[model samples]
Target: MNDLLQTYTFLNQAMQSDSLLCLAQAVCWLDPLWRGYDEDFYHDPDGILSAALVVTRQLFPDLYVDAIDKLRQGATYATVDQLICEGISNTGIPLDNLEYLPYGIPLPAYGVELNDADFYTTHPEVIPILACFGISPEANPYHMTIPDCVYTAAEIIATDLAKRPEEQYQQVAWGLLWLTSATNNSICDWDAELMMEVEPLAWETNDLAFARVMIEEADEIMGDVLTGLYWLTSEPAVMQAMQDNIHRIYKAIQKKGKNNDAPNIRLKWVDLAICPE
Candidate 1:
């Protein structure tokens, strides 16, 4: 981090709070907020910082703004007291230096790709996390390799979907699968099993009222996701097949129910449905 900031020149200066320090303090804030939002923390510097800026600005605008000004002017203190001092007492982050590493989220251990103009145009949400981590992306594989970053990206999908009104369920579910072409493996990757709920097949037909048939059939359409044939996030045929199958299933469920609103019945929870390990 010191090496990276040294390269930035301005960011490295001693405002003792805003630029480097403020970002450091942001880790303390951001580390928990993601979980509160959806319990998924991606740990990408760009996303985390972006979120931190939103949160800190709202919570402590005066102190945060002051820190930014100081960092801009390269302000410094003579005493160099512990972080528990008045500079950032409200956050209750314990330390003298920004060397703490146990937040589970990390500074970019690998090198960062500086100043990606495309990042804003392509993934503006990421600009903030990278800035907080004191870096940016546009390199290969990218922050997706980082476990926390991976988790964050996946969670942002369902991301507190449960918090939303049940009305948007059908549309969000269909649109997401249409764009993403997720399979059982993808669900495991995203733990989207949590997001998913299979309506009990209305008992009108000879089939079990379980979603096992629908998921299995849809997964078959996805064609061997386990062997990596269609393993990536988005496959055109794969996603479309899933979307089509979902429509079929919903129609079937509605027909069985003999009503427009199929009950949101889940025969078995995902963990229970999984074969005993």
Candidate 2:
């Protein structure tokens, strides 16, 4: 098989695996609390700041584990920032001379900027690695927005999809669909909606009949629950149906191979499923 097909198969296998499913569940469970930091930070700076320091650790576990451990031991943000500075220094990227931006600036763009010649020339692996966590180096890279994290992740994935051949559109759609499903249960519905919004025109050319089938299945199985809660409730049967639908589409893509006749299914129900009414 070609590289794109190989990638499709790998992603499908990973999504179908039990471990990623559990990881999705864990992310969903913690999403509400993660979102709360947005509002809480303004009202309770210390508390929210501390919570953010801890959660931000998830983005760079290798570099931030020691920082996280210190935070758990009641280390303040200053202490954590010191640890991060040391970690960056250890990576040979000197941060002491860089000018810092205020916290909460837009992330994906900033992430892109970080990958530019200035930073990437010195830290070649930095952009791709930070892209994974939705982070870009800012002067004050100590803070991040929850929404930006979601957006950056989808943006990076979509950009990757775009760089591939047009025949891979179905795989891109399925990939975004899987990401949407995985992250939908989280506080940010915008990631899925953004994926839908940035959807390439190639996706619009998908087989309408197959698209309708997927939509109807999703509607029947999910109904208003998808919109009403902005997340899937603990409905086992419905969730299973959703998973089966995803796998069915995956199989279809695999069967079609590079035929270009593979269903690039898009659905009106997708908006209704994800957006708040």
Highest lDDT model number: 2
The worst-scoring run of ten residues by lDDT in candidate 2 lies at 101-110
Q: Please state the error at residue 70 of candidate 2 in Å.
A: 2.2
lDDT of 2 by residue, 1-277 (tens): 9999999999878776878786776665444234444434233344534444433344335654565456447775566566665664443332331112112211111112232345445544433333433445564443433333343333434444445444233233333433334323221223333433442222122432343444444433233322322333233333343344444455555676776444453221122234322
C-alpha lDDT of candidate 1 relative to the true structure: 0.34
lDDT for model 2 comes to 0.40
Superposition error at 202 for model 1 (Å): 47
Clash number for every model? 13, 1
- Stretches of candidate 2 off by over 4 Å are 1-59, 97-277
Q: What is the TM-score of each candidate against the true structure?
A: 0.18, 0.21
Off by over 4 Å in 1: 1-233, 257-277
Query: Model 1: per-residue lDDT, tens digit, 1-277?
Result: 6877776776445545367677766765534333343212222343433343333344445654554444335454222222113443333322233222122211111112223254345545434333332244555433433323222222333233323444232233323332233323332223223233322222122232233344444444333322222222223343343334334444455456645433342221112123221
